[model samples]
Target: MPDGTVPQSVLEIRRDLAAAYRLIALEGMDDGIYTHISARLPDGPNGEKRFLLNPFGLRFDEVTAANLVTVDETGAVIDDPYGAGVNAAGFTIHSAVHMARHDAVCVLHTHTVAGVAVSSVKEGILPLNQWSAQFFDRIAFHDYEGIALNLEERERIVADLGNRFVMMLRNHGTLVLGRSVAEAFKLAINLERSCKAQVAALGMGLTPVVLSDDVAEHTARQYQSAYDAMELGNQSDPEWAALLRRLDAVAPDYLG
Candidate 1:
C-alpha cells in the first residue's frame, strides 16, 4: 500500500544503523547475546516490507554493516546473515514494532544495568534532576510478561508504547524507538543515563530534589534540539562521529 522510489539516502541509514550497534556496545548497553537493534528497509518495487537487523548469537560489538541480516516483516530471512539465521525471538519482537509504527525506522532495545534496575523500581524513573526531568512526562511502561517471545505480546507492547520514544519493559529491560538511528541511540543514551543517575542518587541515602513542572517541560524541549546543537560543532568532534570512533575502538568490525 506504499509507493515511492526508494531513496539513495537509505544507504547512509544502513551505515549509521550499523554504527549504532557498535556504539551501543561501546556504551556498555549490550546484554551479551541478548537485546537487538533494527532498521526498516525501504519498501521494495513490489510493495514488500524488509528490514535489517543484527544476526542471531552475534554480540553487539561483533556486528558489522555487511554482516547485518535482512528479513521480511513476517520473520522470514531475506538476506542470509552472512552466515546463519537471526534470532527468531528478537526478530519477532522487532518486526512487530516496525509493522505497527511506520514512523519508527530504527528500533533499539537493551537490558543494561541501570535500565533494568530502574525497570524493577516501583516508582519507575523519577524527575529528580535535569537528566531525569527531560523524560518526566514522556515515558511509558509495559508490565513484563516473560521474555517477549510471543507474537501475541506485540499488541500490548504497541498499545503501551503509543507515541512515546521510551518504554520501560517492566521486569525485563528498556526499549527505545526512533525515526533515525542517531535519534534512537540518543534516546537510549539519555534514558540509560537518567536511570543510572537515579540509582546512584538513591544509593547516596539522601532525599533528592525533584524538578518543577515548568522546568521539566523546558528541559525536555531543550533535549529535543540537543542533537542538532551538538552537531553544530566541528565535524571532527561531532557526537555521532565520536560515538562511531568509540565503537571502532571497541568493535572495529561493525562498519563492515
Candidate 2:
C-alpha cells in the first residue's frame, strides 16, 4: 500500500467510530475526556491488526472522523494526526477484548453515574425491565482492579469478559462490545438505560418486582436472537441508522 494512503474501508470505520463518540456524548454517556470507544480496522494481508481510538483529553463532542487515531495491537499510536494520544487505561481495556474476541470489532466503555453505582452491587444487572432482561445472565463482572493502567490487568479483563458482550467493572463502570460500531452503540446505550432503571428502582427503597428466572432468560433469548439476526445479516441496526440520521442533523461533521 502507499505510504500515506489509507484504505477506504478504514475511512468508513473512522466515520462510524467518530459518530459513535458524538452520539455517546449526546446521550450523556461520555465522561469528559475519559472513557473511550474503539473500532477494529481490517487486518493486513500479513495478519497485522490495527484499531481506531479516540484521542485522550478530547471530549466526545469534539471527536470528528478525521481526528481519530490509528493504533497497533500493542496500543502504540501509529497515525495520530493531532498527537493527542489515547487514554492509557482505555487502551488496556479495549485491546484486551479486541485481541481476545474477533467478533467484538467495536468496544464501547462508559463511566456514567448509574453505571458506577450499580457496579458496586453484588447482584449485577438485575432483570428490572425488558432492557435489563436483555442482559440477563449475560453480563460479566470484573472486580475493580484500581486504575487499570497496569498492563497485567489485560489478561484479567479478557478472562472476565469471557464471551460476554456486556460487563460491569465492579466499583467502576461498564463495558460493551459488538461486531460493528452501530451494534456496540446500541448495546452501550441500552445498558446505560438499564442501569438507570435499576438505580431508580432501588432508590425507591421499596420492594421491587423483579422478573422470574424463566421469564428473564426467555426475554434475554429474544433480544439475543434479534441481535444475532442483525449481525448475521450484515445489516445496520435500525436504531443506529435512525440515530445517525439524527446526528446528521445536529452534528454532521462526524462524517468528516
Clashing pairs in 2: none
RMSD of each: 3.8, 4.8
**Model 2 spans > 4 angstroms off:** 1-8, 234-236
Whole-model Cα lDDT per candidate? 0.80, 0.85
Q: What is the TM-score of each candidate against the true structure?
A: 0.89, 0.93
Q: Give the residue spans of candidate 1 off by over 4 A.
A: 1-8, 227-237, 248-251
Candidate 2 lDDT tens digits, 177-246: 9777877898998999999999999899999999999999999999877787676664446876788899
- Model 1, residue 244: C-alpha shift (Å): 2.3
State the lDDT at 16 in candidate 2: 84
